[model samples]
Target: MDTDIFSLRGRNIVVTGAAEGLGRTFALAFARRGAFVACVDIDPAVEETCALIEKNGGKALPLMADVSNEAAVTTMAAQLEASADTLHVLVNNAGIAIPPGRLLDVSVANWDRVIATNLRSVFLCSKALLPMLLRSKDASIINLSSFLALVGLYPGFEITAIPYASSKAGVDGFTRQLAIEYARDGLRVNAIAPGWHGGTRLGRERQASSEPAVIKRFNDFIQGSIPMGHMGTPDDLTGLAVYLASSASRYVTGQTFAHDGGLTAA
Candidate 1:
């Protein structure tokens, strides 16, 4: 009954790959809602994410690091300790699309790279921050997965890669195991599987086509495919992210909530 149960005021949150796209959106959303956001990205643009937050009257810290590197992740944890004694939320959003190739075509090296980027980074970051999260009264870890993990949908996707799908599926599995291991610590681990958006690989297909007619064709395809009659926006996910990061979801743990406008349902 208390509406304030979702407030993120005074909480310190870290979001990886916050330089742009969904990661930037999540960082800004949390900062606007009153949380001190630590924007982490391998790109220098991560500083821009921090500036945007500060410009909006929110607190932010810019951290540049490769999430896949254990040492870099450990440094982030140490930085958090220096900036904020506790970490309330961690959103592991750094990921990449492997070369578009079938299982047989995908090289062993590419396979390892995809695993390192998509799955290993989540483990390294979560492991590094576990102690800090455990020290908090309420802590949450959100792993970014994909609807492809749910239904193996990729033909229409712009970022078509066999490894991409495989890696996301692994994220789903990792989230489940971590949730169980840390449940007693009051650390809730979960994942979000996003649907089509306008900027991602698939999203760009509808925008940067060779011709207007081709672009319209792609748009029509998605519109007809999704039950919602369209795709989703970054803002469309903010509420769910806020819920899982707040006390509102204290009773929830070890779950992967798909935000794909029924893409996986159909």
Candidate 2:
């Protein structure tokens, strides 16, 4: 089988939240396939991602900005526009999750923060980059969603905050709406809904904030819930990400693909 269809040679891609976790993995993977990646994040560690890509003989640019802030995203767009003439792919991977707790106990501040980071950033970055993306013959936007967006946790099995789920659900809606609006422009919009992925800062944050008993229960849920009987690593999503970002999925859009180890299937 010819693999050239999956090649991203000479493509210009931007990945937000690329300082670590899934974002870093996506940035490196795209660079390996010959794409010039712009690694964007509010964290200074974003430079480390660029260094890794450069060390591997791949081209990368690091940009720091608060994706949830309009002014910051605008400035990031300006920086990117000045550097590249066109954008082939954009990965809206910046997101955060507050600690799990009763909905009644959730604060308005936390709710707004999750919505801004997870949902609003998708809108901000996509809107800011649309002009550049439109310049590409094959443009795609990949949004990071979650299994929680599609299904709610069982009672006593809640490991994620309600705001996290709500924000991801909003992303799914945004992906579909934006795809339809831009189909005539030859732009593809899609989302990746991952389930129980370990080694991510989001998971680590939850673990650090929860009590020992809560952590034990969450672990039990992970062990017993997924049909494949294991949590996934960030590397597990790289292939699907590349597929969505490449010509291989040229005909695919407005869809959310799950990489859940059969957790969603079960």
Candidate 3:
């Protein structure tokens, strides 16, 4: 097979939440494939992501802004416009999952925070970048949903993660609707619903504070539930992300691919 089919050469890609974890990994993956990457994140650590990309002889633009803020998003768009004229891909990966659990554990503040970051930012970034994206002959928007959106699990799976699940479910709906609405405009919208992944910055503080025994038990239980007998890694998403961002998926849109190591199959 000609791997050239998967190349993102000369394409411009914008990745939010790119300071750490999957977002940062995605930015590097795209950069390695010759895409000019824009690493967007609320955290200034996004600069570090871009620096690493540049160190690898790849081009990257670091933009720090709260994706959930309208003025910030607009300013980000303007800054990006000044740097590059066309945006071929937008990865809406910025999100937060905190104060998790059912109604008893979920607070109004936490619910609102999760929605604003996960759901509203997708809307804001996509809408704000439509003009830039429309200028490209082939444009793709890949939103990050999650396995929790498709199933409700407890004890072993996503315990007390209602806000996270809800936000991702909303992402799925948005992906489908936006794809339908923008078909004529030549934009392909899709999503990725990932399952049990590790090395993510989310809940980093908690993990850091966890006792070794507690963490081990948690890991064992979660991995036992996954049919694959293990968890996925940040690098696992590279191919799917690159494919969706490239012409390889020209005929695909409005679909959500679960990169869950067959967990969703059960």
Candidate 4:
């Protein structure tokens, strides 16, 4: 069953925010499995990611674009359509985590940026890529959500702002709607609500802080607190991703895959 289901050969995949973190990891994974990977990111570092992919003998194209901008997404889609004709997988992974602040104390500007960067980008990118997706024999839109959306764990260490959590909730909701609307067209839409996988810059800071005692305490707490007894790595999510992107999850749609290492389970 796995053999026939999880093959991504000859597929064209687009992964946003591929400059670093889980986005880059996902992009590389797809490329490794024989997909033509289009690595999109707002950061110039994406060129380095592109080079790495080529160095590995994998096909990759790096594109710079603000996922939040409709115009940029449109242009990117056009370029992709001309090159790939159709896209088999779309990974909406670009996101922003603004400074922590109370909902009332949060600036309207910050709220706008969070919504645009984290939520609107998913809508814009997917809308622009829909036609190309529809043309594919099989297509899937995979949005990166968070366990915060599922368990109401907002007010991250950096910001107490509600915008980030609110935006992710919106993404989860949008995934369901998109799945329903496009299921008949052989398109599946799903969201992955990952638990505390430490990849973000802030997460790294937390792990490597000068406050050794404090960091140690936090680490111990995390290890004992989570049902899995440890934090998850980006690689831990690849199997789930491969399932969703490949034929393995043919009947799976309009659902959230919580890859939280038993946090959600507990």
TM per candidate comes to 0.91, 0.97, 0.95, 0.91
Q: Determine which window of 10 residues in candidate 3 has minimal summed lDDT.
A: 153-162
Q: lDDT per residue, candidate 2, 1-266, as tens digits?
A: 44699899989999999999999999999999999999999999999999999999999999999999999999999999999989999999999988777698699999999999999999999999999999996899999999988888865655667899999999999999999999989799999999989888887777778889888877888899899888999999999999999999999999998889898788
- CA lDDT scores, all candidates in order: 0.86, 0.93, 0.91, 0.85
In model 2, where do residues sit more than 4 Å from their true spots? 1-3
| Residue 50 lDDT, candidate 3, scale 0-100 | 97
- What's the lDDT of the predicted structure labeled candidate 2? 0.93
Tens-digit lDDT track of model 1 for 123-225: 9999998888888968999999998888864455343567888899999999999999889888999999997776653355335534677667657878888
Candidate 1's C-alpha lDDT? Answer: 0.86
| Candidates 2 and 4, the one with greater TM-score | 2
Model 4, range 1-266, lDDT digits (tens) per residue? Answer: 23666888888999999998888888888888878899999899989888888989899998989999999998888878878988999999998776555667778898899899989999999999988888896999999998878875432333235888889999999999999999999999999988778775436644554377656665675786689788888888888888888988899999998888887777
- Candidate 4 residue 40 Cα shift, in angstroms, is 0.6
| Candidate 3 error regions (>4 Å) | 1-3, 156-158, 203-206, 209-214
| Reference-based lDDT, residue 173, model 1 | 96
Q: Could you tell me which residue pairs clash in candidate 3?
A: 101-160
Cα TM-score of candidate 3: 0.95
Candidate ordering by TM-score (highest first): 2, 3, 4, 1
